[model samples]
Target: MAATSHPINLEVDNETLAGTLLAPQQRMPGVLFVHGWGGSQARDMQRGRHIAGLGCVCLTFDMRGHEKTLQYRQSVTREQNLQDILAAYDRLIQHPATDPERIAVIGTSYGGYLAAILTALRPVRWLAMRVPALYWDEQWDTPKQQLERARLMEYRNSRVAPETNRALSACAAFSGDVLIVESEHDEHVPHATIMSYRAAFQRSHSMTHRIIDGADHSLSSERCQQAYTDILTSWVSEMVIGDRIGHLN
Candidate 1:
């Protein structure tokens, strides 16, 4: 079936967010796409369209202070970013074509970090994160700092900035299916950061991970991008659509 897409504007507390919605011909599970820092929904648009073609409603939106919302960047806060993601989730679930209880979320980099945080806050059934960058309270923290703090008497989890703490806490509690993708040749988001996130998902029921060799943080090459797309689509097929179909049959 052919897929259709349309522009959407989401209203938050005091700002408006711009995004796009891709819908398949039939009602099915919904997928929300969150782009990385400094990126707009454009980065995820193609992926959204492709995923929607596979019978899921997909949403790709620009984060605050990005693309259409560039003017608001200076005023955006970490708390606001969290709010944006929540708002997007709410909007997607409310769509007439969406299955509220069956939803998937895909985020990359900073967006990946946010997606991880969302799982604890929302009823996300499937989650995929590509090179999810770690932050402590929205501020980048060195692995050494995280490690040193853990070694100290101070509770590492509690000592983290509020946002980071919330995400970590949520990840610790979430028991859903998850996919964590790493870039083998990436220069950003070091190995320690990756492991830090891996450690938090101790309770995830099904955790799958992959490393895209020869890919940088952005998966710049055409081959790398295609590999990333394939990985995500395959996971969505198995974890989202396959599971839904299995229940019916």
Candidate 2:
């Protein structure tokens, strides 16, 4: 997969945020890639490459507490990031190359949390979440410990309850199939925690979950990463194929 990235910043309530746009060698669809807590990184960049390789455009943006947003926020919370995501979603939907009906949102950790919160808002065709930070449900610890758990690979069961419940309350209003790929040994979000969120919603008449055994929150294993890519591609395929069928019908 070959991709060239361009740096750009977008405006949200007067603050300019940082981001990168990745276009594939071949054009296919559009993907909005959101980073975890710290913002941009090799992992996110690689994800962009993979999405671009699949012929999709990838856009990654910084939230308020992200490197760019950090300097601007008086305090941070999931609610605050939700607004940023709302803006980001709007921006992507309006981009010249993006077909609002064909766009998908992929978020990691905190970004995943944002994606969950926004799924209720519109035609989000598919969702791919990696080591989603259940911070809202779990105890808030040093960012270091959380990152460590995510990087060292401790995902097992989801204990991410508080936020998941909120996300659950908002999900029925969302329209689309959802996919969540979490770690099996993750310390940050024990499997039980995330499942609590699921308990509230009916399984997608068509949805699946895969556990990256022994993997932690970050989904750091090369094999797991590949699995993640496959899941995302397959979901995208479903989205496109389903849309085609809907249009024809």
Candidate 3:
């Protein structure tokens, strides 16, 4: 029989390539994105997609009073909205590709407040909050829309203790990585509100704080929106990649 020339070149393969091929498939991390009150999942879709590209299972859902549930906006209570968050978290963790142990939650404004409380009820490895809003604990069962806006603003302007607030209390007990982003000129969530959150994460494994210069509460300008997105994605990337590397090593 005549000898045939081999089409494959085994000599070109490297140890790194071989190792990668032999490595076991890892379960992906799960990420849950919670949009602020008056916002819907649409706002977080892009960010979720970007993070999903980094090998995570990302989920974004509207709370009870938003989007499809707009009819409930006038009557939705904080308790009901919290239930929405818990349901979303459960759905994400139940995803087939998710690594339940390495879950992350990213929330903005009112959403951030609920995300913090979520940690107390579930397992969260990383948390990212942008202009997390603070509210009094007394009105837990009251309809969110019925709350006094001026009262909320005044409360947010003052310093709050971890022991006195449900969200802050949860933050006080969290031992995972955290990223707190603040808008330099946010009218809805003042600097004091951010400071209160920052101080509450006393036991976090690591905490990063960033201020988007000249950004307002709503991020009305495109520049401000982009800045916030950049800061959030960068932090999430570092945390997710570092955690994966640690697991592999």
Candidate 4:
């Protein structure tokens, strides 16, 4: 139940990234978790515990806004956010307990985008993306969808700060077994975004898309969270069994 904590100074830059280490009584796999907007490494505490329970080492860390990241300057660029991801990945792989080859990261929304981009840029053996925002959407048939999206953009403009936008923009280099999930009633990203991602990949066999019944954007419902955990664990199971031929779209 106890978790280890550490501070990692960026090797590429010089900033520091705060992280927490969670490990089970047994050694199995190493999972690095990246959270979404207003989320810290602790945002998905339950999921982290679950990963630990599965005998995997879990690493959770705060992004630029969550913890010690405040000490650094405010940044609003994809390059900067990718820097953070690279730093976090480097921190995890350098650990003596981590196999490097067996390590993976679970990202939700914003973090999902980062994980995708990072996988494309780095050497990731596996990836689990939860409703990732790294969409490659190109289809539009209805004008209503655009109008609705414009309204949503206005809302996002009023709420989220500019730095968050920069980070979101930076999450597009991912190319792996991207597991994209959608809550049936998600308030944030529409299904078209997922379609865009699918289109970008061109029916790539490295994607698994699922919809949690009766769930919303946050996956706050107990049933939704349970579904999320189950799907993620199953993905891990497949990875352990070396089943890489994933479903497309």
Candidate 5:
């Protein structure tokens, strides 16, 4: 089926975030796509469009400091990015075509980090994270100099940060379904961090953890990219849309 796509420009605080909305003719489950850090909405557009073709409403957007608003890169903060993410979620859920109760959030890398926090903050039914980046609240919110200095220090108790705790708490409280995609050769996110994320979702009614072999953090190759998109679309179609597509994970 053909899908319709719309350009979206969101006004968040002092900067503008670029986004796109894709939808089928009929209203269905809603899915929001959050791109990784240093990435734009375009990175997820193909997956969003394909999901829309499967009768789902999808929204994909560029976070602050990324894509069209590169000028804001220097000023955008972790807090600001969180605000942007919340605003984007609100926009998607409020749309006339979206069914708020059946919503899925898909994010990659840093975006996946936000998605993890969001599932706790909002009533997200389905959650998907790919190679989610890890950060401590203190380090993430600190100045670049301080953050760099802290990064260079010992790796003692990395998972005890306030923000990480909050996300883990949120995930623990969420009783929906979760899908975690890991890269076999991911250089940014470590296996330990991925395991931590998986552990956080202990309360999820269903969880699917899949790894794409020979794939980098970005799934740079065409073959890996196709696998990423297929895994995501196929799972959402089955769990969210109730279609017997095929096995995922």
Candidate 6:
């Protein structure tokens, strides 16, 4: 005798399956690299490419005073460079693959200074600063090249508090992870400035401080540059992995 055939309900909720499968693929972390004064996006391209390999959307742009805008180096104000950073950040997050909530900013020296202040204005998940320079709040609109070299040197040597400095104030309120890299022999950004930044991160979820031995502010030596790249890439890798794991949990 032939058995009666029963039809199996093979249909699935297409919407539910699509949501499950597409959610994770929809967005990725975004990393924005801001180069130091006198430096251009070319300086950060390699590092940005490395970070991008770790499943992130990376962006690197020349600030107003650098690269094609070299003529403005002597006239560009910190405010203008800050605006550059803000614009780059906005463009980075707007990318189709970028997850606006998972943003990382890496900056060196003057760029670091701007990145710190940017935290106060944007949503940043990770911040990495190398020899972040400190500046007086009094010269907000003055051309960077015109700032008094002597007084700027003196101010960098002195201890500063979060309340008195804009960057420090931003650091004080930041609740994300932070990476502060110092050069052992950095004359441009004194030890006092690094300490001030370190102290200002009162609310950071985690802070990692590193010192590249016998290095200058610029990391001019090849070894020093390689060391910085290693440190930064490792820290970023760890942070990205942790972020992914947290999402899974």
On lDDT, the candidate that comes out on top is: 6
What's the lDDT for all of these models? Answer: 0.79, 0.65, 0.82, 0.63, 0.79, 0.83
**Residue-by-residue lDDT tens digits, candidate 3, 93-202:** 76667789999999999999999999999999999999999999998999999999999999999999999999999999999999999999898999999999999999
Each prediction's Cα RMSD?
Answer: 5.2, 5.1, 12.6, 8.2, 3.8, 12.9
lDDT of 2 by residue, 143-223 (tens): 333334553234324443333455655444444566677787775666665675455446444455667777787766888
Residues 154-244, candidate 4, lDDT per residue (tens digit)?
4432433222343233333344455777777777766665555444554234767888988877888777888888988887777654532
Residues 63-94 of candidate 6: C-alpha lDDT, one tens digit per residue: 77565567778888998888777877877776
**TM-score to native of every candidate shown:** 0.86, 0.76, 0.89, 0.71, 0.89, 0.89
Question: Can you tell me which runs of candidate 4 are displaced by over 4 Å?
Answer: 1-14, 24-28, 68-76, 135-176, 202-205, 243-249
Q: With candidate 2 superimposed using the best TM-score fit, by how many Å does residue 101's alpha carbon deviate from the native?
A: 1.5
Clashing pairs in 1: none
Off by over 4 Å in 5: 143-146, 149-164, 243-249
Model 5 TM-score relative to the real fold: 0.89
Q: Worst ten-residue run, lDDT, model 1?
A: 140-149
Question: Per-residue CA lDDT of candidate 1, range 42-118, in tens?
Answer: 76898887888788999989878788877766666656787899999999988888998889999998788789888
Instruction: State the lDDT at 106 in candidate 1.
Output: 92
Task: Please report, as a residue range, the 10-residue window in candidate 4 with the lowest summed lDDT.
Answer: 136-145
